[model samples]
Target: MNAYQESLKIKRDNYSALESAELRGEQRGQKQGEQRGIEIGAELERAKAEREKREMAVKLKTKGMHIEEIAELTKLPIEEIQALV
Candidate 1:
């Protein structure tokens, strides 16, 4: 082939390779972002559950429940119930 034709073929191949690489990179980034989002959602749920547990412990303590009774009622450790007071 002539020099002009050879140059055009090289340019086309280069562009095709570049486009493929860019698409692969974008797909990888999207997957990573989705996984990170899921992890964050799980962490938020765990934090909410822990907060609810603390609130219940505080409420039971306010009712003047003994530490042992609180432990029995709340099913938490005696020391943990005492600490709540």
Candidate 2:
């Protein structure tokens, strides 16, 4: 091939390679973001369950139940009920 033709071919090949690399990078970033979102959602669910359990303990305490009895009824640790009181 002539020098001019060879130069044009090289330029085309370089452009194609750059385009492929950019597409692969974007896909990798998207997958990482999705994984992060799933993790955050799981954390929120765990926090909500803990809050509800604590609220139930407080309600029982307000009803004049002894801390030890409350712990037995709620199946929670006596220390946890005492802390709520």
Candidate 3:
């Protein structure tokens, strides 16, 4: 091939390689973002559940429930239930 034709072929090959690398990087970033989003959502759900359990423990305590019973029913630690009193 002429020198000009060879140069054009090299440029095209380089462009194709660059495009492939960019696509792979984009996919990797998207996957990481999705995983992070899932982790954040799970953390929020766990916090919400913990708050609800604490509220229930408080109500049970007000109704004259013992600390041990409140801990068992709410799945919270005795120390946490005592702190609510």
Highest-scoring model, lDDT = 3
Q: Model 2: per-residue lDDT, tens digit, 1-85?
A: 6999999999999999999999999999999999999999999998888788778889989988788877776677888888885
How many clashing residue pairs appear in each of the predictions shown? Answer: 0, 0, 0
Task: Residues 1-85, candidate 1: write the lDDT tens digits.
Answer: 6999999999999999999999999999999999999999999998888677767888978988677776676667777767775
Report the Cα lDDT for candidate 1.
Answer: 0.84
Ranking by TM-score: 3, 1, 2
lDDT for predicted candidate 3 compared with the true structure: 0.95
Please tell me which model should have the higher TM-score, number 1 or number 3.
3
After best superposition, candidate 2 residue 81: deviation in angstroms? Answer: 1.6
Name model 1 segments beyond 4 Å from true.
66-76
Q: Which residue pairs in model 2 clash with each other?
A: none
For each candidate, give its TM-score against the true structure.
0.80, 0.78, 0.91
lDDT of 3 by residue, 1-85 (tens): 6999999999999999999999999999999999999999999999999999999999999999999998888999999888885
Best first by lDDT, ranked: 3, 2, 1
